[model samples]
Target: MAHIPAHSDPARQGAPTTSSRYELLTLGDELLLGLTANAHLTWIGAQLGRRGVQLQRNVTVTDEADAIAAQFRESWARADVVITTGGLGPTCDDRTREVLAAVLGQKLVFDPRTEEAIRARFAKFQRVPTANNLKQAYRFERGEVLPNANGTAPGLWVEQEGKLLIMLPGPPNELQPMFTEQVIPRLAARGKLSDQEAYIQIRSIGIGESALETMFECTFSRSPGLGIAFCAHQGQVDCRISSPDGRYGMEKLRAIASECAALLGDNLLCFGHDSIAQVVADQLKQQGRTLAVAEASTGGMLANAFADLCGACKFFQGGIVSTSNEAKMLMLECPECLLKQHGAVSPECAVAMASGVAEKLGADYGLAITGFSGPCTGGGENPLGSIYIGLHSPHGDWAKQLTYPGPRAAVKQRAINDAIDWLRREVLKETHRIAAPQVN
Candidate 1:
């Protein structure tokens, strides 16, 4: 067995200030072949970042025994902690366990406790365990088993000398909970975790990445120990500001955040991980208002965005996917004359649909989307990717037209984001008005 000592400092005590280097090895033919995304890398990286540790590298390999063993040895030699996901099932392609055991010169010991747990889990489904299922019950000769409440494949935790290896199942549901509950606590208890970095995320809409970068560059050009990164999505951008050194503190980060917020202005959605839909929902709930949506070219995606949030039922009354002209006229009571005169993709139709749905559903706010997200145009003056968003609120009715250049799916996503941002701004206006002091 190749023994590698864990990295340690004799002069340090109680949670060291230095961050632990974590390397992740994801094993699956699907990932290496690009048939499946390596979501584990992103998710694990984020979790470790929250704990003030950074994932240094992530290597994805096929389900080959030699390849798996080689990568494990390489990662173990480099990182203080190494974690692997996938290839832990009962199938023939599952090679992580046997490969790692051979590499570590440890025997594969059959654990009766693990077998019993696996049997109990199978019994719950009223199914008998197959012979091959016993493969999961085997553990390392000198290691502890990490129980999996959600699956039959129990995880493994093995250590030699000072280095550690943690193996988890591939299914996200199984992996997420085990990593959170079992892996994190073990690492923390060993004084491997630290809170030495400060991070803040600011989400914004209706802004280009280059524009945001240019705006922030001149202001913070001389600021030392400050780092800014931008992640752009379909219609949103996330600005992450970090100070890796603990000496900077959150006060400096907050002060910098306030400056960024001032520059963002109305373009800023909110801080942290709150999405635009969540922010809109929060505002509506605060105002005791309900919203109904009528979507055309965007289908029901706008509604799905809101419905995905927790407690959406409180503010999201309902939504209608009025794709065809007849459906709009029948379900939302959109004026037939408006559709005929202005066509389905028009500001007139959008406004009518918004007002109609709000009246039909008895909601405080109504949002409508009418667009031509197409390879073909609307067969008139209207070109492809023309979107009209309409809003009918207690205050009044309003509409705006936007042109996006992209494929059908891209246009639809952009339109959905535009509608969400529009509603967010309108709700903010109302919130500000209500909070404003009287001048009497």
Candidate 2:
């Protein structure tokens, strides 16, 4: 529960003197005009953070050369490292290389090696390089070239007056690998990276970020050098507990993680980056059980969630998307009486669908979802965002009604998450009970 300083806080900025402070400058009119999201910020920040490098500030500028130069100058003066993405393509609007060269007080020099590499790459694809594509062969004087294995534009690594500037391509496919292979190793060799921090992430469902924060504050004592951060998705929250202080060892962090796991108990989905579906798949495999799913409004999303996991065929039986009442009755063997009386989106119909699918597929468990995720809803009783999740396990069969306020896609995703979490919790309980010693 220790207070963690925000990234923008001047105090935190001043305190990270040992860690190399990096700033990102994203170029492109698409980003500035909101035509494209600046995804580089998140990806680069995460990569750097994992390596214990602090990415301080991010600035986005249009394709204008002056604006790019101005932002680069400002970022270079403030941060020890400045990384730019975009504007490295073959088009005339791609102005990152020239602008950065001018700002860094270096001339743009064409390298025959780079032009040969580009032409070779084009020849490999049975194509010829265009005149503008050769523009990517230009390098800043006294700068080292970072070869791009994925694209035509080779990245640049330049240093002027002790500050480093790394320019990468805009496409994620090209930028990510180059940064990982080229940028990180160079930084590490130069002793510019800090020691990796110790951290644990606990993903949870059926809990709001605020509520989790309050619970942690009330139950857990504030310990020195411990920091907590929460990231909330549509239906889940990831709680990250870190020991940012280099002096603290993993033992303390593990102890705190254990306490947190015990506190969260049923609400906790899984640790680290494991998805809920993956956890459920593991549980089913451990229990030697199989599952089938029936979906109405969520289409095949609920089924895809499980089927997407590796080796899912061992535990995932099959899925049916029963969009129509007739399909529900014919395919899932849902009773006509239940659908007629309580409507298709009701708990009764949902439960019937679950039971029918389990019986039809001869699986150990059945999960079903019928929802009104839409801009339109059934007139009187059932409104938009109304959802019913049904689960049929070897132990019991039940259904729950949930309401999520959002657009169609958001509502569908939330409903799918809820259904998956419900199934996960039920399977978890069954597994625990089976593992427990019998009380004769």
Winning candidate number (lDDT): 1
Clashes of each: 1, 0
lDDT for each residue of candidate 2 in 1-440, tens digit (9 for 90 to 100): 21122233222321232456789998888887888898999989877765556578999898999899888888888998989999988998999998888777789889999999999999999999989999999999899899999999999999878988999999999999999899989988888864453355678888899988887874346566567789999778988776566443445555666677677778877766678888889889988999999999998999999889999999999999999999999999888888888889899999999999999999999999997998677556778899999999999899999988878999999898889889988988887898789998
Model 2 Cα shift for residue 107 (angstroms): 2.6
Clashing pairs in 2: none
Query: Estimated TM-score per prediction?
Result: 0.90, 0.86
Q: Which ten residues in a row have the lowest lDDT in candidate 1?
A: 1-10
- lDDT for each candidate structure: 0.84, 0.84
Which residue ranges in model 2 land beyond 4 Å of their true spot?
A: 1-18, 120-126, 193-195, 218-222, 243-247, 307-314, 329-331, 335-338, 356-363
After superposing candidate 1, which stretches have Cα over 4 Å from the reference? 1-18, 194-197, 375-377
Candidate 1 lDDT (Cα, 0 to 1): 0.84
